[model samples]
Target: MIGQISEASPEAPYLAANLYLDPAVISALLIEMSDMREPPLDTGFRISKADPELLDVWRRLIGLLDRPDEVPVMAHHFEHELMFRLLQGPQGALLRQIAGTDSRLSNVRRAMRWIREHFAEHLSIEVMATIAGMSVSVFHRHFKAVTSLAPLQYQKHVRLTEARRRLVSEHDAAATVGFSVGYESASQFSREYKRLFGASPRRDADMVQTIVDPGP
Candidate 1:
């Protein structure tokens, strides 16, 4: 998956929250709740305003952080309830596909996993298609439709993103980081890295380091 950028006013406090849904948990909930003949979801991503009920559920779940002892006893219940609320919301179709064993989204996820695992290697569309259990044509269309990126583009994203992380965390030289992420030409790597990140790898690494560990 790719990262999204967010902006906040300098004078305002920014709060962001994310919940990771386990497919296994969703599947279990589907079994206990109403029938799940949900329609196929085309896009793997969606943005919807949270209903009041869903917001309340999140509030209670986050509240448990202040009551750590109650977490062991009530966390599971809150999680299950959260999923139940999500299952009843506009993103229900997306949630359903994640739990479906043989869905287009799941199939695409299969290929995506392979790409992330082998990001530094040469990418083969045929191999990715096989992993997704779809023909190359169908796989390409669905993959792009779901992720808004072609397969190769996704791999490049994975590579450059990984390269940036390594540059900062591993403190590797720009050339070495580029090569480690599958670029044969340092110029090509620097060009693309700048295009994506708005700075050369070395410069970006330095900027991030300055922000993370400003000297006394």
Candidate 2:
């Protein structure tokens, strides 16, 4: 997102950029998708092939990135068109769940958000279930179905992922970072860390450092 200029493509080398799209646009799209009552559309997990029309529309939107002065006025309009196209596409129903208050997916999403904010805290499945407004058994099933992880397993994953980021970038002590992320025992942290990342934290950190800071 920063820097003078960079190109991304599917050709020789690929580059990726993080785009922070306006949440308001996504919310509006979700609402539009969910409100349709005529026989629901087939909501595929992903679109296997690109639609020519949508692809052209996307190209037009991406063109605006080169025109900084016009982006403020033109971005919202482009986003609206893109949202409409998505609502008419195969993933429409999947996108609708993102904005639905009554949907079980929405409830699970709320719980996921809470877990992210308090990943280092002692998490209770019962408490998470209460947050999602479902009984423990029901919430557990739906949550696992949605995320492919049990609640505590999800927390451990989040904790370890965060620990890896801090360890790689900040060179924090493995034991200290482990406790900071919520594990009480350093040995437990090391065991889980190795299991997930395939290396001790120290080794992983060194490997990352070598990749990012290779010097003459």
lDDT of 1 by residue, 49-130 (tens): 9999999989998898889999998989999999999998998889999998799999999999999999999989999999
The lDDT of model 1 is 0.90
Weakest ten-residue segment in model 1 by summed lDDT: 1-10
Clashing residue pairs, backbone N/CA/C < 3 A, model 2: none
lDDT score of residue 29 within candidate 1: 91
* lDDT tens digits, residue span 157-181, model 2: 9999899889988888999999999
RMSD of model 2 against the true structure: 4.8
- What would you estimate as the lDDT of candidate 2? 0.77
Worst-scoring 10-residue span by lDDT in model 2: 38-47
